[model samples]
Target: MSAGEELRARLAVALTRARDRSAALTECVDETELVAQHSPLMSPLVWDLAHIGNQEELWLVRDVGGREPVRRDIDELYDAFRHPRAARPALPLLDPDEARGYVAQVRDKVWEVLDRAPLRGRRLERDGFAFAMIAQHEQQHDETMLATHQLRSGPAVLTAPPPPSPSWPPAVGAEVVVPAGEFTMGTSTDPWALDNERPAHRVALPAFAIDAAPVTNGQFLEFLDDGGYRRPELWSARGWEHRQSATLAAPQFWERDGAGNWWRRVFGVLAPLPPASPVVHVSYFEAQAYARWAGRRLPTEAEWEKAARWDPRTGESRRFPWGEGEPDSGHANLGQRHLEPAAVGAYPAGRSPLGVGQLIGDVWEWTSSDFQPYPGFSAFPYREYSEVFFGGDYKVLRGGSFGTDPVACRGTFRNWDLPIRRQIFAGFRCARDVVGA
Candidate 1:
């Protein structure tokens, strides 16, 4: 196929895959569940359903193709900035059937734009960036909707085969030493990378050791047994205040049974905590407190990126932990193929050059850095996407979780949220400075 033909084919696949995943997420739940706000932190599933279609229409049909608006009157209704999640159910949202039809109509228009456009000249059209952006946007909402599913009160509706078993026995608390060096931090050439992850720059650091894998439930249980949450010294002043005010005892969705064993609810199914799996649904404060209790610290964002992407053998960075190749079923627990995190060391093939395992998926590893811009960062197309959110208020998270799709998750992809927020599938690992390095 010609270059243009190849690009079109890839964009078509990405867009179709996103839509398929969106359908699975919404269809599994009934209309009442879709319309209900599962949590204050998440929009109603129906809102996400229509919002994805609206964003596709706005960015592709109007901005890129310069076509007439599909439904101009509803723009403000679906505007995420205008309506918060808690307020969205009160708005005049398209019901499930209507949302399905609207998205289908918008997608039909998108296909026509794809068929006729030259995919060149304009920056958004170059390399089909706008199309890819829409696909990623839809996939992001798919993840958010999945989170809502976890929050809703219902009996097990979502299910997936458990993640693959580890090929070799995992060294539970093993650490990998990342030697001191300068390595490229972000991407300048990745065609689909968002603005915040642009303009690759050098970040120098001294030697440090990061966990071979994310901290697991068993390890976290040790902290709980030792009164990690009650010991104010283990938490930051702000974290302690939030912990007390919120009565944060364990990860969200977790409770102790009368037998004293911990069980957690996953997508409405209550099960015993899988000790070997990386702990999920944790806030930065919880992760940080655990790190402090362990006498370690969360790795800086640069440190986490360096460990995930840096290739000491070549003194260069890779597009992913495993290399330049895109993720697959064998690589990591991504794309909702599995509903929860895999046992640590499950994907040996996904390990980085430094032998750090499961860095790409399983759980979003919390880092100790604030969301910030790269040295030469400049917003493209718009500022609301990344520029508006940059600051110390948000903590940077590296790696994607089991709920993330491959199109939206990568080594350099950045996800940030308020440090105390915990509804998302997040987890963490610890790092300690190499003494006398």
Candidate 2:
């Protein structure tokens, strides 16, 4: 059909997907699925739904109908964006059905504006983009809510870790080394690169070897068996302090029974640790501790990217090691696979130029560098994109994890979490400098 029809069709499809996602999220009732964060606007499913719904109206309604903005009271009712530490925006507190109706109303208006007569308004572009962004944002929260539902709703004490996939992109324990070379680091082009990863520049490298595969639960267990966590020397001073205060004997989700066998959770299922599965749900601190115990170190963001880059010599700065392709189970353990982290090195076809496997999924590999912006970096459409953290003491992690969206996993895509957060699906791979005489 016509260009307008195509745009309408696109918007219509997005709303339909959003509706389906929203319906699934409806199951997250009364904190069964979604544990409301201390701040309501952050994790309360109610706050998320209301917030996204209001966003649609704010962005699309004026264009579709001659509608004035949402009422000020309504804005206050679900305004979670303004204050970071504020309590969850007090919603109208409608029952689920009523809330769904309100959301549907906004979605319907959006479809109408997108589908009907061609028009050019700055607000159209502005709200259209916002609508899309919020819709995607809500979908992400939808997944988390599902896990939260299972986490809090059931008396489900996790007894074991999830089962691992049998094979990965490469054989277990494969290794690769690259000769010294200079390469550009970070994103040089403007195509959805995060600000912290932008204003890309060049970096020099020396010859070094990297693990072809991520560290496995089985391997990490060796460190644990050797009292890795107990040894103060195996940990950074901060890490040692954290370990002492936390008193964790194993990975965050891992536990051993009288049998001394490992078990943990996958998505929602519990099973034993797959010997070959990349260790997951560990935090940056734990990863660092493990790397020290294993006589290795985590890769720098620059070093990690250099080896993980698609074209070793001259590949485009990609969102993933596998290039621009969106993630799927076959390519990576992202999206709603219900499958947990796969066996390490399973997707050889998706391996990095240096034969580093599972660089985009299985787990978010820890990086050695602290999170910081690049040269000439500028915030994009949203100021919160990067300016908030000029010198924020956050560490950078790369290679999206099992729960990540494919779109969220790019070479230039960076994620940050306090080192102490071990609940997220994070793990680490090691890098070492070859000894120089």
**What is the C-alpha local distance difference test score of each model?**
0.92, 0.66
Q: What are the per-residue Cα lDDT tens digits for candidate 2 across 252-292? A: 66767789888886545567877778887677888888887
Clashes of each: 0, 19
Q: How close is candidate 2 to the true structure, as a TM-score?
A: 0.82
Clash count, candidate 2: 19
Which pairs clash in the backbone of model 1?
none
Q: Please provide, for model 1 over 1-437, each residue's C-alpha lDDT reduced to its tens digit, 9 standing for 90 to 100.
A: 99999999999999999999999988988898888987889999999999999999999999888999999988999999898788898999999999999999999999999998888989888889999999999999999989888888988888899999888446878999999989999998999998899989999999999999999999999999999878999999999999999999999999899989999999988899999999999999999999999999999999999999999899999999999999998888999998999999789999999999999989998999999999999998788899998875999998999999999988899999999999999999999999766
**Estimated TM-score for each candidate:** 0.99, 0.82
